[model samples]
Target chain A: MPHLAVNNLRAKYGALEVLKGVSFSIEKGQVVALVGPSGSGKSTVLRTLVGLTPVTGGNVTIHDDKIDYASSGSLRRARDQMAIVFQQYNLFQNMRIIDNVTVAPVKIKKRPKDEARADAERLLAMVGLADKLNAFPDQLSGGQQQRVAIARALALHPEILLLDEVTSALDPELVNEVLDSIRQLAKDGMTMILVSHEMAFVREVADKVVFMDGGSVVEEGLPEVLFDAPKTDRAREFFGKILRH
Target chain B: MERILEQIPRFFTADNMALLLQSAGLTLAMTVAGCVIGFGLAFVLVYLRQTPGRWALPLRVICVAYVEVFRRIPFIVVIYLVLFFIQTVASNASLFTIAVISICIYAIAYTAEIIRGGLESVPLTQMEAARAMNFGRLRTLVTITLPQAWPVILPPAIAFAVSFIKDTALVSQIGVFELTFRGKELNNQGYSGILVFGTIAMCYFLMSFPLSMLGQYLEKRLATPRSEQSARKIRRT
Candidate 1:
């Protein structure tokens, strides 16, 4: 069975429906990249999965356990199993980098403080930020902040990670550092669903590319198949436009 | 000028000075009681006002209407209303309690706006990040939102309370024996109007100056994020 399955998922922002019966699935250890133009609801799918967006219709399951968005217990369970990194990094401006990574584990998960701190140190070092643990979010470069955000999410020990345009806000020169951290995660068999506009990074790291347009999946397959020879005209046009430059 | 000089000795007599001291202390007491309690209730008001969903629609409307109505009413009118309302209900509520209730009602309306603005100033993404981590709404508020919001909230909140040190003079209309009421009594007793009122003004200044200085110190202290402060502490150590 797939580790996660989204069937006919629907969500809306007030009067406008952003995710119109979108469906996809991710097996354990597979990285699925959701790529599309702006406002295509690619990020909304990730938001809905984490219960940020109210899921208006349909269902999502992890490890074959269905999530009932209306039930707080179920939604909380889903959130505990999945973590999302946002485009803006959204680190707690009040917290040092070390606290940012360890806050949830120690405070919410009720782990011992020393254990959380040690894990935070390990994760921060993994993301190439061991020395800057005491720095504030504003003190770091955008790429460094995003890497810290990743470490923060990892400290939660989520079963599946979600990346919503993680590197979209970075300067071009700073993009590689974050991408390198994600690439290293992918190599270690971590499952992630990423929404990205960086076609090359998506091509490099995504195990399967799911092409989305107008609030639904247009085409999805292996990265080579989907990128080189999309079955849908919409996907072909989108890839043609973005990949051209 | 000679009349004023002679009135100074009379105005500064032990009995009169004691009355002024007592009145000034009363003024400070009511302002602190009213503002601190009101500031806390304003947090509850803002939280209730932000409650989402159709079920909470009426609650949100009530919260918003309370802020709007209280803010639009004059402070003196609120004092009279609270005084009469409390008298009708209990018939024995102290004048000090009535004064505090009036100031609290006024402070809640104004500080609620200040607090709501401060909470909104923290980006929505911060709350979202907390929510995704299974942090409950209240925990997200206390742990995440409130910490970041303190800098934005404190300066304006302290300013409101200090300005309110003067506004509470209106509470004297109901015979609270506070600064203004005592000043009026002293003036009525054949003292120089200039001496009595001028001394009263100095008392007001004396109370507000230290409080505003404290406000400035707090603003500067909290404006530096705890992360940076800890880093500095590490370097010093």
Candidate 2:
């Protein structure tokens, strides 16, 4: 069974529907890259999955347990099993990097302070931020901040991770450091669903590429097939415009 | 001017000085009581305004109404209303009770608005980040939002508190026997206006100056960039 499945997911912000019956599934170890143009509901899908966007319709199943989007308890339970890294690195500005990584485990999971701190140290080490543990978010470069965010997400021990344009906000030269950390996670078999505009990074790291447009999946397949061959005129035009840029 | 300066020494006679001291004590007591009560009510008002739910909606509307009505009216009028209004309900209400309640009622409206501004100054993304980390709303508010909002909240609150110190003079209208009331009595007894008024004004200045200085000091210290603070702390360690 798929580790996570989003079936007929519908979401909106007041009158405007952003995700219209979007469906996708991720197995336990697969990295699914969601690629699309701006406002194509790619990021909305991730937001909906995390229960930030109120789901107007449909259901999500995690590990074979299904729940409606409106149930707070079930949604929170589902959310506790996953984590997200945003386009803007929303680190707690008041906290040191180590505290930022450890806060969730200690507060939400009720882990002991020492255990949480040790876990945070280990995760910081994993993300190449061991020396910066005492630093604040504002003290670091954008790439370092994003890497800290990734370590924070991993600190939760989420079964699946969500990356919403993680490197899009970085300077071009700083993009590789964050993408490299994500690539290393992919190598270590961390399941992640990423929404990205960096077609090259998506192609390199994504095992299965899903093409989205106008709030629906246009085409999805292996990266080689989707990138090289045209299954649909819309996707082909999208790739043509993106690659030409 | 020479006569006024000479009179200042006579104003410190034992009886006059004792009344001035007692009145100053009362003024300090009223300011402290008003701040404690007003801040508590303002906290409730801000929480109601910010929280989402059907139950909180009416309470929030009531809070908005409370802030608007109290803020728009004069503090002296509120004091008069509370003082006279209390007499109709209870003939023997203490001046202390009337003074604290009136100042608190007036300060709550202003404090609520100032605190709401502080709350809004915190970025929306901060709350979203906290929620995504599986934090409950209360924990997110106390731990994540309040710490960031503190720097923004403090200066205004201190300003209000110092203003409350001056505002306590208005309570003298209801025979609270505070500094200004004692000044009026001393003036009635043939004390020079310069001596009586100057003494009360000096007392007011003494009370408010330290608080304003503290506000300025905190604004400068907290205004330093978070990264700079962390770096400085790291160096210290």
Candidate 3:
């Protein structure tokens, strides 16, 4: 069975529908990149998975544990196995870097402070933020903050990590550092579904590429197959427009 | 100026000074109790406003109504109503009890609004981030939302506290014999109104000035950069 599967997911903001019937699945240790034009419901797909956006109709399953989107208990249980890092890096401005990474483990998982602290230190070290343990989010550059956000997500020991345009907000120069940390995670065999605009990085890191438009999956295949050879005209057009710029 | 200075000593006669001290204590007691208790009520109001599900709709409506009614109506009017109404129904209730209840009701409304503003100022992503990490609702509020909102909440909360101390003066209308009421009594007993009222004003200033300064101090302390705070700690070590 696929490690994570989202089927016929339907979500809306209000009167406007964003995700009509989006579907995708990822195997264990697989890295899938979701690329699409703006408002293609790429980020919303991640939000719905994490329970930040409510799914009107859908079924999300992890390792044969199925959750109907309408049920709160199922959503909560499914979300525990998953974590998301947002584009803006959304670090708690009130906490130090160490505290930011440790808070979820200690507060949610009921881990001891010392144990959580050690884990946070290890995760921060992984992201190259070990020296800045006491620094505030505001003190770090945009890229460093995003790395801390990644370490924070990792501290939860999530089986699946979701990246919602994680590097879109960075400077052109700073993007690589954040991407490199993600590359390290991929090397470690972490399962991730990333929504990104960085086409080159997506092509390099993703095992599978899913192209979406108008709130539905247009075409998806292996990166080389999808990027190099287009099966659908919509995919061909999207690649044509985005690759030119 | 000479007359006012002379009256200061007269006001400090052992009996008069005792009464002044007693009234000062009562005023401080009521304000502190009101503030602390009202803060509890405000917490409930804020939670009710944020709760989800069907019951939350009515709870939110009730919270909005409670805030609007208590905030829009004058505290003095509320005190008068509580004082006279309680007298008719429960003659044995102490005036002090009635006074504290009245002040708390008024303070709860304003405090709830200030707290709500603080909560709203916190970015929605903070809650999302906490929830994404599997933190439950109450845990998210306590651990993530509240801590972030606290710095924003403090200044307004303390400003309200200072104003709360002043608002206690309104309770004097119910004959509670707190500082302002006692000041009036002293004035009626043949001291110049200027001397008597001015002294009370100074006492209010003494209480409020420190509170305002404490608010300033807390804001600065909390605002200190974490890096600097850690660096300072390291230097001391």
Say which docking band candidate 3 falls in: medium
Superior by lDDT: candidate 1 or candidate 2: 1
Q: Report the C-alpha lDDT of model 3 over A1-245, residue by residue, as the tens digit.
A: 99999899999999789999999999999999999999999999999998888888877889978876567788778877999999999998888899999988887788999999999999999888899998889889999999999999999899999999999999989999999999999999999999999999999999999999999999999988888788999999888887876
- How would the candidate models be sorted by lDDT, starting from the highest? 1, 3, 2
| Correct interface contacts retained, every candidate | 0.77, 0.91, 0.89
Error of 1 at B183 (Å): 1.2
DockQ of 1: 0.67
How does the DockQ of candidate 3 come out?
0.70
TM-score head-to-head 1 vs 2, winner: 1
| Candidate 1 residue runs with Cα over 4 Å from true position | B220-237
* Model 3 chain A lowest lDDT segment of ten: A67-76
lDDT of 2 by residue, A32-145 (tens): 999989999999998888888888888889988996656678878888988999999899988889999999999899999999999899988888899999888888999999
Instruction: Give the runs in model 3 whose Cα sits over 4 Å from its true position.
Output: B1-10, B223-237
**Which digits, one per residue and each the tens of the lDDT, describe model 1 over residues B89-190?**
999999999999898999999999999999999999999999999998888999899989989999999999999999999988889999999999999998
Best by DockQ: 2
Instruction: Evaluate candidate 1 and give its CAPRI docking class based on DockQ.
Output: medium
lDDT of 3: 0.90
